[model samples]
Target: MSQNHTWLEIRELAEALYCSVKSVYIYRDKNLFKAGTHYYSVGEGKLRGKHIYNLELCRKALLERTAKDSRSNETYDNKEINKLMTRKLDNKNLSYRK
Candidate 1:
């Protein structure tokens, strides 16, 4: 861990990020942040434990995720438009045959 990075508890992280605690947990559960990089479990056994998060890592992960999602959305939109254009051309061809 870099000395400049801040590690924070769930509540503190939420406060710092201006989000709810549940949102932070959602990010963890969804695997948006990798263990040992963005966060670490602090407890014994398999029962349950507190998670300390690297604030900088979490922010970076979120930014990457957002960029990836934006690219995927653009690709999806392009595919949909192509499908619609293909359908229209097919309809036109059928009309000419009639």
Candidate 2:
């Protein structure tokens, strides 16, 4: 993901990851990702809180979890996932892009 990209809301992240919002919450509870690293909470109203995820860190967390799960036969090509995530972030002014 590019530096210019904005934080992703939980719903946006769920959509990007092709998972349900509940699954995202489950992943959080399971410690698949950590707060302030993979995600952070935002104030919605006077007392309401909402979550926003860091796209790059979320991708990193998923990669790490997949690496540590020896019993899982699922295989992921990280390059492809990275490309897709970067595209979803949609940062148009990336420095490396000419």
Per-residue alpha-carbon lDDT of candidate 2 for residues 1-98, written as tens digits (9 for 90 to 100): 64754579989998888888898899899988688778888775656478888776877788788787865776569998888777755467655835
Off by over 4 Å in 1: 1-3, 75-98
Under the 3 Å rule for N, CA and C atoms, how many clashes does model 1 have?
0
Query: Which ten-residue region of model 1 has the weakest summed lDDT?
Result: 89-98
User: What is the Cα-based lDDT of residue 35 in candidate 2?
Assistant: 81
- Please give, for residues 10-54, the per-residue lDDT of candidate 1 as tens digits: 999989878899999899989997788899999888666889999
**RMSD to true structure for each model, in Å:** 6.8, 18.0
User: Candidate 2: misplaced stretches above 4 Å?
Assistant: 1-6, 44-48, 71-98
The residue pairs that clash in candidate 1, if any, are none
Where does the lowest 10-residue lDDT sum fall in candidate 2? 88-97
